[model samples]
Target: MRSPADPARLATLLEHRAHRLRRDASAQAEQAAQRDREAQTLRSAADKRLQAAQLGEEHGLDRQRLFERLRGVAIARAHVLECELRAGHLQEQAGDAREQEQQLRHAAAGNHSRARRLQAVGAHIDQKHRQARLRRQERQIQEEYTCR
Candidate 1:
């Protein structure tokens, strides 16, 4: 900005970090929900198939193949449930990491703001010292001229 000494830049950085953390956290949550939904859908579909097979087996030679298919579906369901659980865990981890990053970024921003304040204070002190020296020199000059 026009005022390079302004504190707005630090604010903007902190805002950006907060925004990113929220975005990432939401994304992780959504993905976890999606995976859970997928696993549930898969289980429902398999259950429906098994139910249909059981009903049809009363009519003819559907038992053997149906049993095999059901077995495979059971295996697939187990695998899908495992995958869903893993996805959920990963999402949780992502959320935790995002939280940690947010905390770190916030701390960094605060530290940065403090550092800038200290620098500004130092500069102001230095300026005052310079002005004091200038005033002393001017007084010495005036005294000598008056004596002459």
Candidate 2:
């Protein structure tokens, strides 16, 4: 059975942490992609609205109708602007998530390195113990043969 101080055990713990970090990073990346898509969708809707407003203006109309058309266009423009602002906020949130993910990844890597170092120390200790045991056995044999 491996002892509590075993390098393998420490490595296992570190690996688990690394896996969790990687998962988090993946989630953040997905969120970023979602935000980018939302921004694009908002921009497209705004363009469509602007095009419609221009087309409406192109049609010949009485002054009263023209004033009404302007009002409608103004409302559409406001809606478009609002959507664009919301999309921008989402994009910023996504960027923050991505940065958090990167930090987690770095932490996981550090843990992995620490685990490896611990394992090396454990191996070195084991080797020294084995050499001590062998030397003792050799000394005992020499003493017995000399006495005989």
Candidate 3:
């Protein structure tokens, strides 16, 4: 059975936890980036559709053709609006993912700091133990020499 107060063991555990948190944060950041790219693509498509509609409007045509063109423009505008809404939703999701990633990163940093402190304490304890052992050995050697 391992002692619960073992600093080395506690440090290892904290280090592992920090690693996992960092991995999770990296994954979240990737997800946020993907969402941003998708949103940009949607916005690009919407812009293209709006431009086409504008170009169609600048052309003069007969009444019947004009009405047909207006209908097409209205449909295109509706599609653009829909695209904008979807892009907005994606942007919102990306923002949320970014926020989550930041939080995870912060938590990971805190855990890493704790692990480092624990490791330092463990090293100090080991050094003290080694010094004590050396002192004991030196005292024993001195006593043996005196006995001789």
Best by TM-score: 3
TM-score of 2: 0.80
Assess the local accuracy of residue 5 in candidate 1 as a C-alpha lDDT between 0 and 100: 49
What order do you get sorting by TM-score, best first? 3, 2, 1
Report how far off residue 133 is in candidate 3 (Å).
2.2
Candidate 1 lDDT, 34-138, residue by residue in tens: 655665675666566555544333445477876776776677666666666766665666566556656655665665666567556656766777999999999
lDDT of 3 by residue, 44-146 (tens): 9988988787634355688898887788788889999999999999999999999999999999999999999999999998889899999999999999999
lDDT computed for candidate 1: 0.62
Better of 2 and 3 by lDDT: 3
Q: Which sections of candidate 3 miss by over 4 Å?
A: 1-4, 55-64, 142-148
Evaluated with lDDT, which candidate comes out highest?
3
Q: Candidate 2 residues 68-108, lDDT tens each? A: 88888898889888988988898888889889878878887
Candidate 2 lowest-lDDT run of ten? 51-60
lDDT of 3 at 64: 91
| Candidate achieving higher TM-score, 1 or 2 | 2
